[model samples]
Target chain A: MRATLMPVRIADDLYEFSVKDPPEARALAKALGDHPLALEVVAGLDRVAVQFAAKDETEVSRWLNQVAAPEVTHEDAADPIEIHVKYGGDTGPDFEAVCAALSLTRAELIELHTSLVHRVEMIGFTPGFAYISGLPDDIEIPRLDQPRTRVPAGSIGLSAAYTGIYALAGPGGWPLIGRTDAKLFDAARDPAFLLTPGATLRFHER
Target chain B: MLHILTPGLQTSLQGTPRTGYRAFGIPYAGPADEVSMALANRLVGNAPTATCLEITYGGFEAELEATCTLAITGAVGEILLNGTPVHAHQTLHGRAGDKLTLSPPQFGARAYLAIASGFQAQSHFGSTSTYLPAQLGGHEGRALRTGDRLTALSTGQATATLSTPEDLIPVFSDAFALRTCESAETHLLAPRSRDQLFNTNFVAGRQATRMGIELTGPPLEISGDGLMKSAPVFPGTIQCPQSGIPIALSCDAQTTGGYPRIASIARCDRHQLGQIRPGNSVLLLRRTPDEAVREGLEKQTLLKKWLGSALP
Candidate 1:
């Protein structure tokens, strides 16, 4: 069945598509990413905005009318990238506090975090900062009362429903549980960002 | 080479915006007011997208190490060349060792300084414009400070002296009536509150930054859940936080936001958001999407008359 794309005009050249859930939004975003006229596509949690290269309403309308909604595949075809993490030490100052808040021991916290495969819902806030979805509900917690002045790059942080990676050092409020040596972002690299929307990843405890 | 005697308030190099990277959480960091920047560049014979100096709230002073053709445009009070007053929005000739200074602005908040061949800076993610938060692009990826030295990209002589026509020069007023269109969550607002958003004159709060501007006025209550899933937001997006204060996102705003997007300033009126200062009055006039697009096209046609393809 073709998914309906009822795009609402956001600006002269920008249009937004609101979907029922993240999976649908991701599928729509992936389809729009390949559209010839799309200059850019930003996928939020439940909506996707496509910025056109130019204001060509006729072409846009025709395509929208004719195009079929591509298949919605929650599981990515490629293997999940593994991120090695060092949990619960100086690298993760909030580790003890987070464990206590969630009523779990260090090993249990690490196991719960690494057990599930998380999909990158979006990359935002800062360059290469990936918002990963699929965090277990039982261990979800609020962010720090006061944000840290600087979060080390490669820091693994968790919020209520999402886990994120700190691409570069700056102010952050997410409760950190571990640190990784893998580079999250390098502007000089061809693919400046280590993660992109819809990519699946799994955390591995060292 | 140009020597910064006093860097004023947050002076930096700006040029064409970095595009095609917003999907990776990058912002389009370009000149706040593209019209003024283009005018300044026209006076010095530089391309509209050439790198130039963006000075905020005036009080900038600089010393020249070489003779060059230059132009200053935007809000201003007094322009002094070796203590002799000069005018803005016109081409100027400077000699080696000459000192140029600008006083506080009389109305607007930013000024554009363009040299004959433009300034040279390191490009990051595609443009020379600076993104301060990520420490990317421009000179050292930071604001210009005292004692900084910058070199001109090229030393060619500028085109014949020219002045912006009086009628073409934009006037910065304390009050602005910006055209806007309803956004994703506009209907979520109470019917009375929706009317209030259009009828009331909101005052710009002091918490203004390059990323966004805060407006204070009568609280516009939202009948439904004000918070929604994070969604893509742009420079002109007006997000209403739970505090009831609406914030108009600017060029450096985040790629996405969680606040309810109440309205979006029309593209034609978005440039003015760069000049709005604390305490300024703003009225968000409602317009349909079709009307907003037509206005933007009309404005672009007007801008193309003198600025060529330059559209703010």
Candidate 2:
């Protein structure tokens, strides 16, 4: 897919250029690494953020333009992880409200959520918390009016047009629909995080 | 060995970050004041990124369960070894059964304790730095409590003799200056506001943490419609939320945020931000990218020089 590069500044010395697509960003990252400046590639689904140190905004802008080249597709694509979840209970306090809002039974909602494969668009909020896209339109739910003081780790939640899994217990406003047993983040592991942007994920009812 | 007789405020282990995991939404959680932390490590001849205790607001009392060399840096606090005064930045040999007491800091907020061979703690994400929210890193993923004992990895070398006078130790003071550079959202603010930003003195608000340091100042009006889609944020980012008050991101800041950033504090002056306590007034000076890079490089060179001299 064709992608456009957008130059964005993160800090004084840190300038980032985001590619509209992942392939182009990865390609740019590979090419830019040969340059004297260090290049950090932060990949998202539709965009890839490349950060570098620069002397000025003009120099950073020039570098960003110079690095924008033809997209190179990755040979080894990201793998999809399948996760099982127990939906609707005290663990998922907002599950019933979500089902009622969607005019569907808990079973139907589970079927809808499980049927479609989701792509990880981004990861944010906390460690290993993947923001997955491509959820079924029927399962879309709004976030809570008041964010819970603390969201338990592995709590699967939905808000607006996105679905996410919380890796750490912290304050969040997303509507809880289920809980997953899969440990998304384990610092002891070699890679640390199992899910990366562009990786696919499928949810199943336990 | 260091035995915690009393753990005051909050204290945890910290070191250089475990990066390359930010894509997983994990922040590279490390020492808040990296420069100071490195200096402490250097004084004790430990690796620059070695794990150390990050004590906040002091009031911590520990007994030297075994003889060891240690150094403290960052905040200006009273340190006593066996009820006698001890220097904060210089390495000291604590004998077995010696009691170390740290009173509340008279200036600044946090202090770092570095051992000769560094503190031995469990590794998380390849580092001992604690990310408290995730309950990861440090000793069992939490702060040190009373009666907790910490073992120092065997340090064959003795304490370094201070070439510089004791008074030369970098101590905290109220008159610290923070440096800044224009951010992406600088254009979104009123044209005159850019000039006003450098002219205005802002106060550090109570709502501050490792995640972000919120500043209270004259409300800055901007022409932007609303918050943009969440984008990656780094330390030194000066983000203005709906409240219009600017907040500077710190070590534990989120990977991404939707707030409009006004300016980013320069890397050289970030330590000043870390040392600032609530209600402290700060003046923001505008800097160009070139100026920021030069300053950062200069700071790095100084750090390297100090490290080379301090280490065996």
Candidate 3:
């Protein structure tokens, strides 16, 4: 059975749709990714908000029906791309504290972080900052009480069930587990962001 | 090159926000007062989306490198041509050494100065608007400074004059009434919070900048708690954080936020937001969804009819 669609009013031009979970949300994103009225699509943990150029209830309902279709599958079609990460060193300042809080050793934390392939849940917070799912629930942590004045670019940060890489250097509170040499965001690049929503990726210790 | 004699508090080249990129966490970062920017471009016979200088709170001056014609719109301030006062709402000419100076904004919070050929500022992602947070676009991706020299993308007619209809100009005042409409979480707010949001008065906070306008007033009460799953937010989204102060997002707002979106300034009345100065009292008046769209369409028709040759 399919999950129930929960539509939330975000703003005059925005309507947010939440389904069962991250995977079900991805299915909804796949079904309605190309609607002309969907000027912008922002995928969240369990929801996807579409900013319509013009608010049309009928179009929204039709789009929701398409998302609710039984044939939709959650997996992204692209082959997983692997990212190189240097974990628990100068690159990650909060790594030891995070490991201790989760009662994990350094090696255990790295193994847990890289054990499974992750999917892009959303790209928000900052330009090119991708929220990736698949961090071990056993070691899931909260964002720092006080955000650092600056979190260097390519730093891997974890909060709750998701982990993300800082695309641009700015203020962020996500607990750093590692850093990557990979360029997360490059304006000169054809695809500016390393991971767009629905792209599957895997992180490995460098 | 147009010599920057003095840069205003915040001066930057403006183009429309980068659309379709919001999903990537990029805010549109366009001109805050699009209507005024359009009028300035129209008067100079430039494309509506052509690059122009958006001067915040005036205090800007520039030297004409070559004889040039330009148009100014938005703020009502002292316009000096070679130290001589020149009137606004009409095009003005300057010789190579002629200096144009604009005093502090007397009526509006921002002003537009569109040169004949539009600015040839550096661009990223096909937009010239400066987004300060990311240090992207404009001259080295920051606000204009005194030593900064700008070049026009192209040269146009040396001399021309045009005036916008007086009826179209939005009057800037200490009191602003923004027609607002409900958002998704508006229903989640406490009944008293809803009443306070619409009926209460708020003074624009000192934290007001291009990104958003912070309002100081009674904190809006809400029973719901916890950060929202980050979602797409527009320029007009009114986010009331736990602090109770409401921040009305503007052209430079972030792509998504976790704050409760209690209301949104209607699309039609958003231009007025650019003219609202900090400390200005704003009233969040209620508006129907139908009325919001109708007014926006009406304004679009008005712009098309008046600037037929200039509009896209």
Query: Pick by DockQ: which candidate is best?
Result: 1
Model 1 docking grade: acceptable
Among the numbered candidates, top TM-score falls to: 1
Q: Estimate, for each residue in B119-185, the C-alpha lDDT of model 1 and write its tens digit.
A: 9898998899998877788899899999999888888575799998787799998998899989888
lDDT winner, 2 or 3: 3
Q: A181, model 2: CA deviation in Å?
A: 4.6
Instruction: Tell me the spans in candidate 1 whose CA falls farther than 4 Å from its real position.
Output: A1-4, A20-27, A34-36, A53-62, A73-111, A137-160, A166-183, A202-206, B310-312
In candidate 3, how many Å is residue B307 off?
A: 2.9
Candidate 2 docking band: acceptable
Model 3 misplaced regions, further than 4 Å: A1-9, A23-27, A30-33, A54-117, A136-157, A171-182, A199-206, B156-159, B309-312
DockQ of each candidate, alpha-carbon based: 0.44, 0.38, 0.43
Q: Which candidate is the best by lDDT?
A: 1
Query: Over the stretch B1-312, how does candidate 2's per-residue lDDT look in tens digits?
Result: 888988888899988675655556767678887767877887888777799998888999998877788888888478998889987777778788999888898888888898888888877667778888876788887989998989887855687655323433566765556779888678888877777788888888885577667678887776755344445667788877555677888877666655667888887777666677788777888788678878776666666666763211
Structural RMSD, model 1: 3.6
Error of 1 at A1 (Å): 6.8
Instruction: List, in order, the clash count of every candidate structure.
Output: 0, 1, 2
What's the true lDDT of residue B205 in model 2?
82
